[model samples]
Target chain A: MTMGFEAGQDAFARAVTDPEAALPPGVTSRRGEADAMRFAVYRNNVTVGLIRALEMRFPVARRLVGEAFFRTLARDYMRHELPASPLLFEYGDSLPAFIEGHEVSESLPYLADVTRVEAAWTRAYHARDAHPLTIAELAAIRPEDLGATRLVAHPSAALVRSAHPAGSIWAAHQSETVTPPRAWQPETVLVARPDMEVTVRILPERDAPFAQALLAGEALDAAAAKALAADATFDFGSALVGLVSLGAFSARTDDEDLPK
Target chain B: MTRFDERETGLPRRSGLGLKPEHYQSINDGEPDVGFFEVHAENYMGAGGPPHRWLETIAAKYPLSLHGVALSIGAAGPLDKAHLARLRTLVERYRPASFSEHLAWSTHDTGFLNDLLPLPYTDETLQRVCDHVDETQQALGCRMLLENPSTYVLFEESTIDEIDFLTAISDRTGCGLLLDVNNVMVSAVNHRLDPYAYLDRFPVERVGEVHLAGYDEAQDGAGDRLLIDAHATEVKDDVFALYEHLLRRAGPLPTLVEWDNDVPAFDVLHAEARRVDGALAAEAARRNARAA
Candidate 1:
């Protein structure tokens, strides 16, 4: 039976993403028969196109797991979810979480974290452009008012804290030969596009709380307190300078009405 | 019909190439003399980045053609408002010389399928497509060119001919057509029809631009020839011959050489485009000689 356009599309889309499903109704070949091979072309295009998009966004993950395994993981992920939007770059936002629950996580414990870093890097690369806060601007605040001042995080700034050294693993894969990291330790990676270039840096362990709080919109004194509570040796003086140098904060606008 | 005279047309009657990111530096440094450069609209929908920076530089030097792949103009539902807003933003930012989209649908109720899937060419779909073209033209506040699709399977329920369907859309909406010679070749072979006959029935007067690309060959379930519209290699010899045939009839419309997958160096693409330019030049000379 012939279906309506909407029904036809519903059937076609269902079959395109599911290999086991039959071809949609009303589809035919010139010879007047259902041609599965001909229909397979659309199936291949959608699956391969989406998988390739993921591969392009997460090259390091693909390299780490090998192309065959990465495709397997991507295919598994596709079974549960498809892109809700046409923006291909933003399609794989949930891939890290998907990988965390997959059985592959048992074999590659750090894979999900590495994917998180890769995902954040892409977000930073495409984030809105803004002028980064300068050290001079920070110094302009009165000494007494500094503790109460709220520094705005750059739109592109993202913090990915991992129990594994995902940042070092990601950096090590940049070259042809992948060498083992010097030490296996936790890392908190900072991703920000201060200017045109996207910068990815591993934050000092103790400063993670401070950067995290500031990024979450905590005031200067409150963020510093969080860092001190995390570690007694937390050096607030250098961490503030380091984050400003890294362009983690946006230029402050006096128009914002701060609450008392 | 909305006839775009020589002055009204945006693209020059020469050969162009699809702009790839790998060749951005080469294009910037060499500043090659070509007709224009075409880009996919969805690729630059991001808020800000190097994509915009490079596009800004390239658009300044060349005539930009914005081709949208994800608009889903043939969908059964209303147009995506957010996607239309983004397209409008892109048009405003680039002020491209030409804008075009496919006649196929990729978005369904579930989500975007990311591939140009086919639809039945019945009177129902024809009215739907005309409505879409009208909506898109109004949204962007500019005329759009709709291109034909290469299909693997046909719909038994389709009552209208592909040519008639496209002609009706153009006539009803006053939109232009983009005749992709490769798509004609591919669709003809898959449907067991003569490519020349398809071109003979095409509304060439309304054509604003032409697209040329390569197709991969395979056999269907019946062991008949099946051609996939894979833009991974140079334009096939048969497709180029068809293009030359088109130019002879259409009189040197703006042509674009598209190589999306397994892209080669800038010089290779430039050379392919030069090959097209050679054909366009010969056609123009023939027209001049006839005039004399």
Candidate 2:
């Protein structure tokens, strides 16, 4: 008997996700044998395909965990999470959390954070493109208006904060040799695709407050104030020059600062 | 109305290869005489970046075809409008000579499975597939070619034959066909059917393009060989024979050699495409000699 579409899909989905599950009703292999062997092909395809998508997003994670170990972690995540959209690039939003909760990966506390930085890099790479604000544009802003200027960051800009030096760890993997620093240090990473090149740069913890504030739509005056509050040694001028050089902002509005 | 009727010209009757990102520089530098390049439409769905830039450079010289793997045309639910919109944008931007999707579904009510899951050949599915094709055509404002899936398992469901189902969909929706000879070979070997006989009954006239890919050989518990449409290796000699047979009957068509996994060097894929071109030329010569 022909199975209904919904029922057939339900069984097929279950069988693919779980190997022990029996083949869906009305399914058989050639030579009239059990469908288990053939069904495994689809199961393997789904598992392998999703794992590859995740691997593309988190190459550093793969390198950190090694090939076989990473596949095991990724397969566990795949069993629990299916891609909500056809966009494979956006499939690993939960990977950081998955790695964080994973007990086997608990020893590597910094792994999840590194994954978060990688995810941010991918999102930034695929994010919407826009002509970034030039240094000349910043210079053109009136001196008096500079503090009150509200900067608009490009869609391809992202800031990632982590307790461990995940950004450094990720960078180390990019080159031939990967050597962690002797001393452990927390890191804040800025990921952006300015001029169509994805760049990941590490920032001081003090810069997090300023970048976070600006990304949250705060005016420059309050953002700098918040940064200075978090860390007294924060150099506003150097930070501004660095950010502008990174092509961070897409537009800057000179709206008057509201009375505080 | 038929989109590929007398008023329209289909893809060039020559050989093409699936475009991979790694081969972008080599393809541009060497500028191979490939008739066209086919890419999965979803790969270029990014807003802007290297994908678009590379596609632009390639499109400037070669005809392109947007082959989609995520449309899920045989699913029970409504078509995903957002995905369809992205596809429309790509088609508009690239203006590929041919656009096609699999007859299988990769999506369900929950989320995309990301695999070309098989469907039972039944009247219910036929209606669902036809409706999906119509909806997709209406949304894209252009005709699409529906590919026959390479299925591993067979559904015991009672219904029409595979070729009839495909032809019915074509007849009702006025959609063209992307006859994947590798898929036919795989399914035929799996089902113990004659690959040649399967092609003998195929609707050659409705075929707008052709696909040739490699398969992995595996054995069942009974020790019988099974062919998996893995697209990982070079085209098998048997599959190539089937391709030659079909080309001799259908004349030269837009043929694509798909090597997605374990993608070989540019030279290797180019050699395969050239082999297909050689076959097409031979077919043309045979036809010309018969006419003379």
Candidate 3:
């Protein structure tokens, strides 16, 4: 008996993703015979198209591991987790976590963190558009009320805290001639698309806590206290200015009135 | 409003090129003399970005065709309502001259498979496709052109002919057809059918637009010629001949040159579009000669 349309599609989809699976029932060629080679076209399209998407999304990861190893990793990752959405750009959200658990982590401990940075970069690129708060707007706020101000993070602002020098690693791979980082240390990278351009900046380790707190909607005084507690020498004024210049915060719309 | 008329494509009868990011700067600066520009709807689904910015600029200058690659109109289940809503939003935003999708399915129970997969032609599948088309047209408040698929494999249970199946869907749903000539060559050669005969049988009156692309050749399991719709290289001579033949019958239609994979520089793509324009002009001259 021939399989119904639904069952046949179910089987065809299964075989398309899984190279080892048998050809779906009722699938044939002009010769009226089961043709694995012809069916392999669909299989190859799904796998290769997805692998290319991953390569485009994470060029740094692909470059670090080489094409062959990256293809192997992507194939294994795809087999377990196919994209559930049509938005290919948003497909590999869980890849960083997946890489963390994979055996590659033992060899390259920073691979997962680098993938996280790349993933966050993609997220920031596609995040909703908003007018980034300008430094001029910050200067307008009264000094006494500034500490109570809860500046909103830009829609595209994202901070990826890594135990490895993932930011330096990603930056090195951007150019043709890559220079290895002089010293390997933990880094916190900020990914944001304030206006048109997506910028990746490595923040000072001492000020990461404050940036994280501010991005989390904490009041300015509280965020400053968090940074000061982490490092006694942390400068609140400079860090706030650096983040504002990086377009980390959105313009104040809802909270226009100062807290009296 | 009543069902959309097939003649109301809102696109000029000339050749266009698929828009690519690499060519955006050149397109913005030079503003080449192409008929229109087409983009994959999913690429612009992002809320706000350079893609949207460039598209907004280009759409203001030229006609836009919103082509969708992942609607999975042939899927057995109901259409994805969320995706349909997204399409509606895109339509409202761009107000493109024409919109199209494939007759193939890409989504299934598992997830969206990126490639356009073939389906069996049967009464059940036909009814499902018709329903999907109706829903899509109603949701977007505009007619859609369903392009035929390039298949490497066929189903033994297929009861209806491909051309007839397409005609039936268009007739039932009041949707128009997008006759992809390259797909005809690919499918005909793969299935041991005649390309010219397929064109002859196609309902050209219902065709709102046309597509021209290149295909990569390979061999099937039985060593038979298999053609993959790679859309990577230049349009094959035989495919161009088939397109010219289509032009003789359909007259000048809103044609698009699609090079999705391995996209070349703007000059190369523009050169291909110029070649298409040459054929279209020749066809127009012939039509005038006949009228005169």
Candidate 2 at A138: error in angstroms? 1.0
Between prediction 2 and prediction 3, the one with superior lDDT is 3
Question: Counting only residues 3 or more apart in sequence or on different chains, how many pairs clash (N, Cα, C under 3 Å) in candidate 3?
Answer: 0
**On TM-score, who's better, 1 or 2?**
1
Worst 10 residues of 3 chain A by lDDT: A251-260
Superposition error at B27 for model 1 (Å): 0.7
Better of 2 and 3 by DockQ: 3
Model 3 clash pairs are none
Instruction: Give a tens-digit lDDT track for model 2, residues B1-292.
Output: 3343322325788999999989999999999999999999988887877778889999989988889999999887778999999999998888888889999988877678999988888889999999899888877778889998898888888478899999999989988888999999999998899999999899988887899999998876677777899999989999999999998788988899999998989999999999999999999999999999
In model 2, the clashing pairs are none
Compute the TM-score of each model's chain A versus the native chain A and list the values.
Answer: 0.96, 0.94, 0.96
Q: Write down the TM-score of every candidate.
A: 0.97, 0.96, 0.98
**Which ranges of candidate 1 are over 4 A from the true structure?**
A253-260, B1-8
Clashing pairs in 1: none
Residues A1-260, candidate 2, lDDT per residue (tens digit)?
Answer: 56688788788888888877887888887676565678888998999999999998999999999999999999999878899988899899999998888996678999999999999888887777777878887888888988988888877888888889888999999987888755589888898888768999988688789988887789888999999998999988888878877877787865243222
Worst 10 residues of 2 chain A by lDDT: A251-260
Instruction: Return the top candidate by lDDT.
Output: 3
Q: lDDT by residue for model 3 over A98-179, one digit each (tens)?
A: 9999999999999999999999888888888888889999998899888888888898999999999999999999999899
The docking quality of candidate 3, as DockQ, is: 0.82
Candidate 1 chain B weakest lDDT stretch, 10 residues: B1-10
